[model samples]
Target chain A: MSAPSSPVPAPLGSRVPLAGLAVALGALAFAVLPLLVPTYQVSILTEILIFAVLAMAVDVLAGFTGRTPLCHGAIFGVATYVVVYWSQQGGAPVTGVLLAVAAATLVAAIFGLLAIRTSGVYFLLLTLALGMIVWGVCLRWTSVTGGENGLRGTVRPELLAGHLPFYYAVFAVVGIITCVMWRFVRSPFGLTLRGIRDSESRMRALGYNVSLHLFLAFTISGFFAGLAGALYAMFNDFVSPSTVALSQSVEGLLMAITGGIGTLFGAFIGAAAIIGLENFVSQYTERWQSVLGLMFILIMIFAPQGVIGRVRDLLTRRR
Target chain B: MDRRTFLKTSVAAAAAGAVAMPHVARAQGGPIRIGLMAPLTGVVAAGGREMVDGFNMYWEEHGNEVAGRKVEVIVEDDAANPDTALQKARRLVEQANVSMLFGNLLANTGLAVANYVKGNGMPYFIPIIAADDLTQRNRIKNVIRVAGYTASQFPRPLADWALKQGYKKVATISQDYTFGHEQCGGFCQTFTEGGGKVLGQFWHPLNTSDFSPYLGQLANLGADVVFAMETGADATRLMQQYANFGLKGQIPLIGAMNMTDQSVIRTMGDEVDGVVVAAHFAEGSPAPVTQSFVAAYGKKFGKLPSLYGFSMYSGAMWVDEALKSIKGNAEDRDAFLASVMKTDLTGSPLGQTVKMDDYGNPIYDVHIRKVVKNKDGKYWNEPIANYPNVSQFWKYDPVTYMKQPPYSRDFQGIKKS
Candidate 1:
């Protein structure tokens, strides 16, 4: 494989500062949203924050590394169940959180290893198979996961028990993580990942270990996905097998694509759209699912770059 | 301004105006809101539809008013998932500010909702789900199980009747879940204690398409009777395969009420003949209330009301009775709960009087019925036996029964062929 004679330049100049300002303002709004909005909106926004992280994880794999792994939801769910079950069985909060994150990373590593060998559709299929295995375990292992009923009444500490504090906690964690991810993508390592996405053989020829980088990328994505899951378990005060199912993985991927494949902020926009549709739109009509599908279709046809990406592009073009 | 700018500003103003208008309208006059969460989609859509219809039937009959106040029900489809059920419950309680909550079809969803309501200190009337833990170890004061026969309660009377009939050997086939485990456990425990011989028992997955494999084992065991606990379409599919395997009439099939639901029996046609099951409600009862409900439900839904539909209808009646007793006052939750506890739904959908047990469960009639062809060639469950004022723990001490573990898939007492 040959690289383009004239490689596409990195995003730089005036656009970078403007994007930074936008992100900062977004963070400020998210931090203040709970205080201003109703408890229901706060709850919905918390979920959006958590799902945004998961969607961004998907964006890293599918957008940067050019691989779509369907097991990310399973990775998320495994972490949640581990933390929830541990907490339910009298484990300390910090220890439970650590174990959950570690478990997610380990599952991600295993799933990544299996999927890294395969490219394109095979990667998606392999990850889906892995995700199904996790879902089955959650369903059948009633002793541990509470089977189909799901493990509930998870004991969260006093600090994070209330909705207001919990939303802030999610906001702070997601905000820091998003900043880290922003820097990671703009760094040399991130550039190398984009290079791999552009042309794998060319990158391999330039002394980059392609599979190792991709595997690391997958593991990192899983780490963030797991973080989101652990927070989700705490937020919901319950964990279920549905969290590990293929539908959830598909949702993450859909959010990434809908937000704009390669854009980081697009993940958040996409999550907001999906979660808002489920919560707010469903309140108005019984056929909200159909309406959601129609919205997605319209977004795909008209705003092909995604809500954030298209808005950003239009702003830059106008300038 | 340009056309586009003018159009955008007008639309934005209209949206803002619309959002601000609702609170004013609500403040002037609002109905007492009751929220319902059910699996209105997914695999249980049929059951969900039936339950909602039952709830609506009562309101429609009474002109959508309880006492002097208007009653409004807000329904949310939970998709039969526990997580979604809880989420919808939160939306109902916190967001919609519903005064009361009711209706959940699945046991797990009921438990999840129970936890939420108990935590929030809300009055919840559970009509359909009969999981024992809801009334036993997991029992919370605020949750009122309207038709409170647990899965265990369904099978005890059947086991007693089986012993009376001198059926010594008992084989069980049940769904592999919380509901099925309790059902088969109750039957096996009671039957074994009553001098019945032990036989093979099979716990199949909830969505087993082919029961031939399990039926083969049942054939080999050759028990005197099979106490099966498959429900909904699974029961229909299992009976169809049981007939296909020529074991329908050969084996005396006794099951929970789910097996011979009016809908399931209709689907299976005449193949489900003579299949005895135990339940709280039956179609062919001599009670005038039963006959009236059967007619009213049929006319409204264009189909016969199943156990779920009947229970939901009864739940509405009980709610109405309780509300009327309190003069439609739901604001004081403690008083509302007291009224609910005092509710005796006589002349309601189930065709018998009922009251809450000491544990917030129900003390109601349990019917052991057989699937028989009617004069019109339609199949209905004809009662062969009835147990009145049955509690969730039957006659056993609640403390003693609570000591034993809830029945699960891998109980050690079962004997395999």
Candidate 2:
């Protein structure tokens, strides 16, 4: 079909020091945060970790793959309910959590495949629609989902021991997920996805299946999103449709942008800043949600690359 | 990272864990632990804090002692959101180790804790937030309520108030939720009973900031009276919008106290005057107890206290006082929850004695209050009439009401169909 498409880049699997360093730092913070902050803040941090995982998944689809899959929140909620239902049915909580991610991956696979037929804004709308469908299902299907009353999210059984042990468990899992994602983003598949994002028609002419690549990338993202949801469901001991609403989906995007979408550590930093700010702001102002929204808008305007990503861009650009 | 250093750190961590573990255990205490989960840090945080103050004052006057131990009131925020309410419930049960959980200031919060406490087997007695279903059909066992259910004293009392005022035609406007539905349902049940007709019906999203359309809809109905249910900022905004439509002066209005509380009246200004509201207690309730509460509450907080504070105070006191009756080990789950479940008798500060049936709703009096100008220049609630034994038609059959789907249930006068 005309000019040859750019060759698929080779995987850069040998070493990625930044990702490893981030994990180490995260593990250290995980150990320290509980000691330093109150139980409430620790609870808040645990939530941040959950959201960070979900945001990273969104970043993978939006940044690495360049096709925005916004239905990540709903997919995450779907996983959460699965975990919740399993737990209620006497399934091991951990097994239920894992199943949540698996189910999410399948949903993402199907959604992604259906969505790949569209491009750009159409792709975004498809994801949004899919997310709303999940919200509607959760809202209308009250017998199972609890409707607006919401299922009582019970106290999660601590895996290792208590709060500190729980932190380490989340950190280890998050670190591994991040490492895998980091590797994937720099691999040949990552490069091809980027290429497709940059020029999908050209890739199609080059005989590469753009839809397959996009679907796989989205499926992987959904897997992580589902994992985060399962973790959250177990952690909070509750699941509701509000968790999967369009607002949460938007907040995930905000997290990615606030942290620097392309960077691996951005999601963690974003989650931390957002959650920590929310906690502090709530203590001071009754209008904290509005204040957080303002901060989000400011970040959009001023720190659009996210704190870490912006710093990275600036330092790299200067050099 | 050496063995000696690692051992020291491990010991330190273990010691810290040891210290925290007792707090978790101490929560399951000898004292009657009354957990107060409300929206203490959101938009209604002001009212929530006020409620907490009222509760703390009641505890303080009673020597802050219940069940012979220092009463520890664990205050947590439900964020006026159901999800947060659920989380706070887990925190209260697992961490706070509360003997009895009480006082929900938000409708969804009460519903959330009601459902959750069912599993915890804690007698979660809610009195402040009147979400009818919580007491009616959604009445979870081990959860008793001292507050009036939305269904019991709705549409009827106010609808009658309208009929008494000689306004035969009425219109309804409310937030679209379980609480609003029940309030309207109750009003309709009573209104229609006396042959009063509701001419207009309008519903708006809970998150809606605009009431122009709904206000205009009610205005266009040409009804002699407007009976509505709106709360917090929504109430303030809706009333202001209602005033703009010139319905405040043109049409007589009667709504649930939630439609316009102390905050709403203060914010809604001239529009608040002549607005009739049916409630358990009002700012200027003729009862000497209410006057003292208002004085004590104002002295403590420097503002008129909302019904939230009143209900929360009663809820906390009900638990604190009920624990006194059992005199068993406060931490004994069976003894304490059972003691609370025996709260079929409620003799509290707010005028009427609350009698909770098996399903935990107070089968007690509901009142008809109206906004009238007092010497204070500010419009204060004056309890012009009282329905001493008024309760939901289904009050005696709480289990029956509780068995119905929350959606299928209606306020006493409101239509289930």
Candidate 3:
């Protein structure tokens, strides 16, 4: 049988200049965004970047491995709690980051081990159950997690205390992570994951350790999610049970889907759309939730493959 | 017109309108803009609406002007999340350009906003958040709780009453949170100090749909009285389930603030009657000030104003008093805060002359109330007893209290007298 075609078409040589120009222009806009907007809007932009990292994590498993893990919110939440807990205990920021990411990676490894054996809906259910367990722990473990009130008193490192500086710090971290994720999804290991997504049995017959590969992909996704969570904990200087709630997981998934699953950069677009709509739309109308719901429905109907996916489809048709 | 020309014309119009809006607002004598943040669209939306209504009612009575300045309240929904509350606080201060900040429902949101406002030096008045640290260890000068009590403040009176009634053993079932812990801690501290034994304590997560599990365990505890701490929907469900489990009248039921609050009691049936609670305000108060406030609120909203509404109403009065003293010049932040701190409200709906303590918390009477159906056949909190001039530290020395850690699940303040 012939090899399976890639979901995204290979970039045309003639389109290279346009893509490079677009990338450079987008970067320039983001770099100067804080200066253009009000301080409050800068905070909103920082939140979008952090959440975009979370969306990218969700896309990693859902778009590449064909496994939609519902527990990444819990993974992100664990890191947030770790950072807050560490800071509350007077730990340094660098060490807090190390501990937070390590804790998140460990939680992800355990969840992956339990879930990698299952596929399709079973995998989703298991991850959901694990996520619920984490939520329950966050709620009941009153001392460490601060129960429902959550742990407060997180001091931003003295260097990035100001709003503009903090926004840039988040921008830099998210920028680096995005580059790393971009490379990860295109690597040979990422190709095998995609191959498994297309035909798991075929990949297994080809002597690939499917569970191990899936486990590694899940852990890497958790690492990025943890980094985002760390940034979020610092940005908000607070963490609560809402961070680990089921709605958070669903929102991350929605962002990935709305941007274009499997397209890493689409996560950023999706994050911007969701964050912008939630904040700015509410300013204009009290029925903003209804407006948001309506937008989601329109997107699903008009662009089922998401905004980026539809754009790519249009470009392919032109060819 | 063609599409390009039409677009250009509309864009120019929109830009002109945007630029002209603030000038128009300023032309209206620069109304005293207060940013009111509440959980307007979340689990506590009902309570949040009541807060806004109560606050607005005061301004409405004065024709939307306070102290000769047109009061424009820009309400932003925090959705009961701390992060969202902080963001809204920033938007209110930096973008909306509100001179003052008011209204927060949850303790976490209150603390988050208080911290942010403290840094920004905005005058924030909390009407209904009961977080202890807001006025205790971490008190911020710019942040004042105008018409609110600490979570533990009201419970102290209830504990004293329970002991006077000769109840020797007590059990507590509270929502597992800081608010819950503080409420239970205060009660237990007073009860144990008076030789009452706390047989057991049970905590359930917030928004717990079912109370059967906790009720079943409580039945076995066989305490002389059971003190419950819950709020909003959880309080309504717990009261209903307590009766359903056949444990309602078997043991005396005492509640912390908000369990039998007007907001929750309105939703509850006869199962909640006779339950004792401690709160700063009782809607069924016989005082002339409360009666008039209740009559006006009922005539307009067609319901008894809950504690949420009463607090905001009184909080508005406090702000009005302060603004009137300073000639409505909220632009002078230091003078505004000084005027606010010196406020002595005599006709508050809380049925007391409210005054601020040194710690930026209110010092007022906490009423021991019982749930009862009034002549209108509607349930309301009826004042049974009053603890006059109650403070956040209760009877404990302020220095000693500050030295001790804030109340938590592990530290229930079981004083070994």
Which candidate ranks first by lDDT, i.e. highest? 3
Q: Which stretches of candidate 1 lie over 4 Å from their true place?
A: A1-9, A315-319, B1-30, B412-417
Give me the displacement of residue A197 in model 3, in angstroms.
Answer: 1.8
Tens-digit lDDT track of model 2 for B16-73:
4321222344634466667777677666777777777777888887888866678778
DockQ of each candidate, alpha-carbon based: 0.38, 0.16, 0.36
For model 1, name the residue pairs that clash. Answer: none
Global CA lDDT of candidate 1, please? 0.81
TM-score of chain B of 2: 0.85
Tens digit of lDDT per residue, candidate 2, span A1-319?
0111233212223324654576578668666767775454566667788889998998887776666767988988889888877876777877887788888889888888788788778888988999999888886665677665456544367454365677667767877887888788879898787788668789899999888898788888899999898888766566666788887888787788788766656788778777666544443344667888898889878876678655655645664
Which candidate tops TM-score? 1
Tens-digit lDDT string for candidate 1 (B1-417):
365864565466345421111221232135788898878877787888888888888898999998788998999988887777888898887777788889988887887788777667888888887877878887888988876567788788888899898899988888888788888888887787778876877888888998988999998897989888988889989888888898877878888888888767766676788999888889877678888989888887777788778888888888888989988888778999998888887868677788887788888688888888877678888788888877778778999988888888876233233
lDDT string, candidate 3, B318-394, tens digits: 89988888888888989999888889988787667888888888887888999889998998888999899889888
Every candidate's lDDT: 0.81, 0.70, 0.85
Output the better candidate (1/3) by lDDT. 3
Instruction: Tell the DockQ for candidate 1.
Output: 0.38
Look at candidate 2 and tell me the lDDT of residue B104.
67
